[model samples]
Target: MTRKEEVFERVEKSILDFDGDKAVEVAKEAINSGVEPVEVIERGVRKALETVGKKYETGELFIIHLAAAGEAANRAINEVLKPEIEKKGEEIHFTGKVLIGTVAGDIHEIGKTIVSAMLLASGFEVTDLGKDVPIETFVREVKEQNPDILGMSALLSTTIPVQKDVIEALQKEGLRDKVKVMVGGAPVTQEWAEEIGADAYGVDAVDAMKKARKLVGA
Candidate 1:
């Protein structure tokens, strides 16, 4: 394999092994060897997470494995590549800008964390508003950030209505047409997404990446 290809392989392996330090080492090596940070994310980290997502879907990998892989990928990006890009004053060619959060009353964050990592690897600039985010916070962020997409997660059945409430808030503020809305979580369904006027319903992190790409025409 070519040198960059070899580095990409090692990066992918480091993530699959859930070795954040190794992933960071490989990321530094990639930067030193003249690989663009975005290229590492797209060809290396993203490819690895795609496999992990498939394994999870087939029941070969569980939630813990997913979380581990996500953590490793995030460390490689946040710890290594990000700083390098900022140092070089390089403009990251992001696929799109996404604002994501877990709805109010739901402290569940595992799913949102995974999706954020996957989205970052997929080349989207993601701003994670974190768990238990209030409806007004969602609306205000959309207004301020003007992101290409707004994603909401609600793991609990009772908290699911908060997703709809946020969408309604966006409409009330007349910002509904400014950005696409995506909703997901354990209790979220396609029917629910449609009923709430969501632009897309993500079944999983992989699906979320795909739908986000389509939503932004990336």
Candidate 2:
């Protein structure tokens, strides 16, 4: 096989093996070997997470496995791939900006963190507001940051209503149409997103990235 193919496989394998250190090593090696940052990310790290997601869906992998892979992928992209791109005199321009937070009453952050990493890797500027964020904070940030997209996540059925409240708050402030709204979490559904007037519902981190891209026409 070609050198590029070999390096790609090596990086991909490191993530699949859930070895964060090795993934970082391989990512740097790929960069030094003239592999493009985007190639290493899309072909290696993202592909590995996609597999991990599938394995989780099939019950072949536990939450720990997915978490480990997510951590490794985040390291590979942020610590290695992104720097390489910047070193190449690229400005790391983002196609869009997103403001994300976990709605009030729900403290779940794993999903939100992963989605932030993935969006960052995919070249979106993300401002994370942390977990159990108040609806007023969302409205405040939306108005202040003027982000291209606003993402709300909730891990509880009760907290899901907070997403609606935030949207309503945006509409009341006349800022609803200025940005696209995306919602997701374990209990969040596409119907719920629509019912809450969200422009998109991300089923997972990857889906969130895709929907964000579509939202910004990227």
Candidate 3:
């Protein structure tokens, strides 16, 4: 097999084995061997996560297994992939710009943070607005940053309506169609996403990254 393919196999194995150190080691090796950082992430890390997702769906793996893989993938992407991408001179550009935050009255951030890291690893420029962000804040940032996607998270059922509020604010400001909106969290559903006029709903971080890529045509 080619060197890149060999390294990719190692990466895939490391992640499946939940070996963060090995994943990082092989990822660095892949970069040192002149593999593109995005290539390593997309072909190696993402493929592993896709398997993890399938395992979760099939009841072959628990939440802990998925979290372990996600953590290992994040570490490899940050310590190995991102650094290499930055070393590529000035020719590199982000896959897209994404603004993410937890909606108003929601003090939860774990899900949002995970989604942000996944997007960043996937080569998207991300701006995290943190938790308890007001609807006006979301609207203002959308107008200011002009990001390709705006992702909102709400862990509480009560705060879920804040997503609709933000969307309405966007429409009132004439910016609803300017950016794609993605909504999710523990309580979010595909029905709610469609009801609120969101462009997409991600069930997890990996799904969010995939949807973000599609939104940007990457």
Candidate 4:
């Protein structure tokens, strides 16, 4: 196999092993060996996460381990991608910008973090508003940033309603149609997103990135 493929395999293994630092090292090796940033993410890291998720589904890997794999893969890509992102900046320009947040009354952030990483990998600049974000924060950020997409994540059933509230707030400000909106999390579904007037609903981070790209025409 090629050196780039070898580095990718190593990074994939490191993520499955939950070794964030080592995964980053392996990604750097891939970069030094001439792999593209997008390639590292769409190929190496995702391949690792797919395996992790399959193992999780089979009960061979626990939730904690699955979370760790996501974290590790993200960390590795973050390191391996910085230079290429900069290079791409000078070439294609960024396709879109994003503002991401976890809704109010919910403190979960891991999933949102993963989505943010995936968006970054796809060349969308993201501003993370973090956990327990209120509608006001979403509105304010959208006003200030005028991003192409706004992504809301709610892991709790209780907080899922807040995602709609944010959309309503956007409409009230005459900004709802100015930006594309997306919703996701454990309790979120495509039907819910459609009912709430969101542009898309993603079941996972990878899907989120794809939908975001489409929403922004990027």
Candidate 5:
């Protein structure tokens, strides 16, 4: 294989193995060697996550593995994509800026972390509000961040309605029309997202990228 392909394979393997620093090194080297962040993420990060997900479903890997891989890939992508992302220049088209957070009462962040990395790969500037975000925090972030998309994530069925609460808060603040809302979670569905008035539903990190971009018109 070519050097770029080798880097892709190495980075992919590092994420599957949950080797955070190794992934960071491979991703950074891919950049230093002139490989685009988008290419590396599509060919490596997402590819690796797909494998990890399959393994998880089959019990070859567990939730611990999934969480570890997600965190590792997030760090690696952030490190490697920073330079190229900064150099995006002023005139480029973007999928959109996204404000991402896990809703209140949901401390699990694996899904949100993976979603953030994939969005970054797809060229969306993401403001991650971390886990267990309150409705007020989401509204305040929208007012301050002015992002084109508000991405709410929850891992628990009980916490899913917090996304609806955030939507209500945004609606009450008259900011609902200003930005699109996207929802995702273990128990979330398109019907639920629609019921909550979300612009899109993300079934996974890859689906999130496409759905968010489509909603934001990018």
Candidate 6:
């Protein structure tokens, strides 16, 4: 295999092995080997996570596996590849800026984390707010960051209401029309998303990336 292809293989394998350190190490090696940072992210990290997503969907992998793989890929991208891209004065050509979080009272982050990694791999500049994010924090972030898309994940039916609350809060702050809102989780449905006035609904990470791209005309 060519040197670039070999580096891509190691990067993908590092994520599959769920080794963040190895991912970073491979990322630096890729740069030193003259592999473009964006190519490493798209061809290496993205491909690895796509496989991880499929395995998780097929029940061959558990949530822990998905989380570990996603986190490892994200760490390498954020900590290594991104800095390299910056150093080379290369604009990432991101699809858009996305702010994502798991709504309050829901500590479940596996779904959100996977979606965040997928979005990042798909060329979206993602800002993850982590789990149990308050409605006010979402609103505050929307106003402050002014991202193109805001994605919320809630794993529990009880916390699903928090998604609506956040939307309403955004409306109250006069920020609802400024950004497209996407919602997803185990219990979130198309009907629920519409009822809550979300701009889009994602059934999974891949679907989320598609919908997000469409949301921004990317």
RMSD of each: 3.5, 4.8, 4.8, 5.3, 5.2, 3.5
Lowest summed lDDT across 10 adjacent residues in model 2 is found at: 86-95
Question: Alpha carbon lDDT of residue 45, candidate 1?
Answer: 86
3 against 5, candidate with superior TM-score: 3
Estimate, for each residue in 1-218, the C-alpha lDDT of model 3 and write its tens digit: 98888888899899999899999999988987888887888788888877877786688986667767867886887787877777775233568989999999999998998788667556676788999999999999999989999999999989999999999999999999999999999999999999999999999987998999998999
* Model 4 residue 95 distance off true place after TM-score fit, in angstroms: 14
Cα RMSD, model 2: 4.8
TM-score for each predicted model, relative to the true structure: 0.74, 0.64, 0.64, 0.62, 0.62, 0.75
lDDT of 6 by residue, 1-218 (tens): 98788899999999999999999999999988888999998889888877987887688987678768878887898999989888889866567999999999999998898888777655678899999999999999999989999999999989999999999999999999999999999999999999989999999887998999999998
Candidate 4 backbone overlaps, count: 0
Candidate 5 accuracy as lDDT: 0.83
User: What overall lDDT, based on C-alpha atoms, would model 4 receive against the true structure?
Assistant: 0.81
lDDT of each: 0.89, 0.85, 0.86, 0.81, 0.83, 0.90
Give per-residue CA lDDT, model 4, range 1-218, as digits (tens).
98777777887788878898998888877777777777776667777777776675588976577656766765765565756766777332455888999999999988998788667545566778999998999999999989989999999988899999999999999999899999999989999999999999989986887899888887
- Give residue 27's error in model 2 in angstroms: 1.4
Model 3 poorest 10 in a row by lDDT: 85-94
Best-matching candidate per TM-score: 6
For candidate 5, lDDT tens digit of each residue in 59-175?
Answer: 897666776786777787667665576576413234578899999999998798878866754556677899999889999999997999999888888899899899999999999
Root-mean-square deviation of candidate 5: 5.2
Model 5, C-alpha of 38: deviation from truth (Å): 2.3
After the best TM-score superposition of candidate 3, give how far the Cα of residue 150 lies from its true spot, in angstroms: 2.5
Clash pairs, model 6 backbone: none
lDDT digits (tens) for residues 129-214 of candidate 1: 99999999999999998999999999899999999899899999999999999999998999999998999999998899899999
